[model samples]
Target: MRIYLDNAATTPLNREVFLAMEPYFFENFGNPSSAHHHGRGAKVAIAQARGIIADLLNASPDNIVFTSGGSEADNTAILSGIRSNGIKLAITSAFEHHAVLHTLQALEKNGEIRIVYLQHDAQGNLSLPHLEKLLSTNERAFVSVMHGNNEIGNLNDIEAIAQVCKRYQAVFHSDTVQSMGQYRYDTRRLNADFLVGSAHKFHGPKGIGFLYRNAGQALYPLIYGGAQEQKQRAGTENVTGIVGLAKALEISYRNQEVTRQHLLRLKERLIFKLRDRIADVDFNGNSANTGQSLNSVLSVSVPDPNTGISLISYLDQHQISVSGGSACNSHSGAASHVLSALDTPFGRATVRFSFSRYNTAEEIDYAVEKLAKCYAKPGVSAYAEGLLL
Candidate 1:
């Protein structure tokens, strides 16, 4: 009875995706770069996958470039866009994941780019006025913002941000890995110059992701090798992974509306149960009034001075899976930057529970009951403190 509620970190691979990739592993294994029939078969699979992904994003197939994963896609967008466009500054929010933050920081330290961190409101909403001020101050720069936050589940107003970027004539990029399969995405409406996503975030295989480079924008290559991905990313393609990605995206898109409705219901149920059962538990993202949060993720903070890691361990022992923060940095033992941005006083107790289509309401109820019991135990608090210290 192990319940998995950490879909934001990575989803369980779908059976359909795994089945689609089986043949490519042995029977049809071929390097897409080679010239024989086996190679042609792999090339055709890659092309079909690219087309499917392009259709999902509402962009032409030519606009998409395959990468190793989301991190590589982020690096290609920020570092390559800055290098190619000669933009010396990058504007991003304080709540960005480390993939974007670390890349920007490294560039800043190398004296190649100036990084400006935008402040957010207490509800995790970006300040449009502050964004305008920064953009106006730096007329030409590269901007990277995520479509939906990985930890707190707050979705940014990409349309408003894009309008500001248009006014300033700056390059805009978004990390769409968390939002892509969960919501409907239209590149034209987003009006972003660069976008990134990973397959593993949406029930696809790992080690594969894509970057959407708007037409007419050129990005410098991160790796140099034989020309592939239109010479933008040069490496041998991961044929099986790419095939699995396409199948996953296709199934996700076909079921998007149904999945969204199911997740929204689960979110409502979880929120209600937590409020009824837990004391002094506060949500860290936008309230229900703002209409800006994603239904797939729900973050809660307990007021007790207990470490989330301890709660995570208790949940694990009870056969429940959840996360304290972004899985990418869970081991670091540092405060979540997203919670800090929201000015949450109980940031140390924050725990994120994200859902997917496979999640059930029974599991949610069990998790809430277990959490309430854990919080009421005085010994649990002491144990949590010991581990933190």
Candidate 2:
């Protein structure tokens, strides 16, 4: 069936978004940096796209700064925000994407800042009191928490978290890459200083995304020298990608409710089948909770951890693709930071099966059948319940 269940890593580009970008790539190809007619046209197109994105979040076009993708946007937000605001301490969770974690780590390594991790329960819920304590004692702190956990699909209460951050006057930056298109965001009430989005995370083209900086926030330019991005980001803009992103985001918002409801059904079906077909099967974090977890993600824990790679390969051989962690971090064969933070059962394999609007019930059935077959293979009885690692 060749089913793709890894939308969290990146989604296939939407046809409408592709068509929207075609004109910009050829007949309308012009450097937005130039001051000619063609350049002016491209500039206007970019401005229109920016306005659409800003409108989606109830933000101003002036607050949107386009970037390569979520990673770049996260990097720019963290470094620039800290430098410009004299933020010396940061609050984050152990399960945060490395985009935010690594940046904070580097800064802390160089004595640029101090980091405190928020307390989280086994189900990946944060302790609000812990956040309140950390925020209360820290001055000019940078808080980097994602809207949803990429590995485990636990959705955070950004609004509640934002309230605490506001009380402490902390600069809050959320990596909204995973939740941008799937959920609605109203910057008018989000109470955040910065939010980031990546087009590829939705159904838009790769290599383009944006950072939403509140009007009053001061962020230094991570990239040096260029009048582009209103002097915020350097280098020429990616006009085509920017257009596709805008179009894709528009489509996502338009179809968000229906798509979300449909994918939620697929997830529920997969969960039911996983339990029915496999022995001692379990899920990580809030992935099994439709109301709390992301509607598109399901992180399954099988009995055998040593066969993690084999299972993925076996599924690939059957033309069904899934993941063990974020595409960026899974190849290292190390446990996912998110799962590790939740203290997932020792030696149990974790397979993340994420979905998008394109997936179907038939594909979900086939994936479950293949997964059960993979675990039932001969001579691996050590995976039996009593022998669990």
Candidate 1: stretches off by over 4 Å: 287-290, 305-309, 346-348, 377-389
Worst 10 residues of 1 by lDDT: 380-389
lDDT of each: 0.85, 0.88
The TM-scores of all predictions, comma-separated, are 0.94, 0.95
Q: Using alpha carbons, what is the TM-score of model 2?
A: 0.95
The best candidate by lDDT is: 2
lDDT of 2 by residue, 248-299 (tens): 9999999999999999999999999999878778999998998898998899
Most TM-score-accurate candidate: 2
Tens digits of per-residue lDDT for model 1 on 1-389?
99999999999999989999999999999999989999999999999999998988899999999998899999989887788888998999888988999999999999998888887777877888988998887659888889889888888988888889988998999988898787777887778999888999999999998899899688788999889988888889999998998898889999999999998898889889988877677887763322678888888887555454477887888899999888987888887777777777733477789999999999999999888775555335544545423
Query: By summed lDDT, which 10 consecutive residues of candidate 2 come out lowest?
Result: 380-389
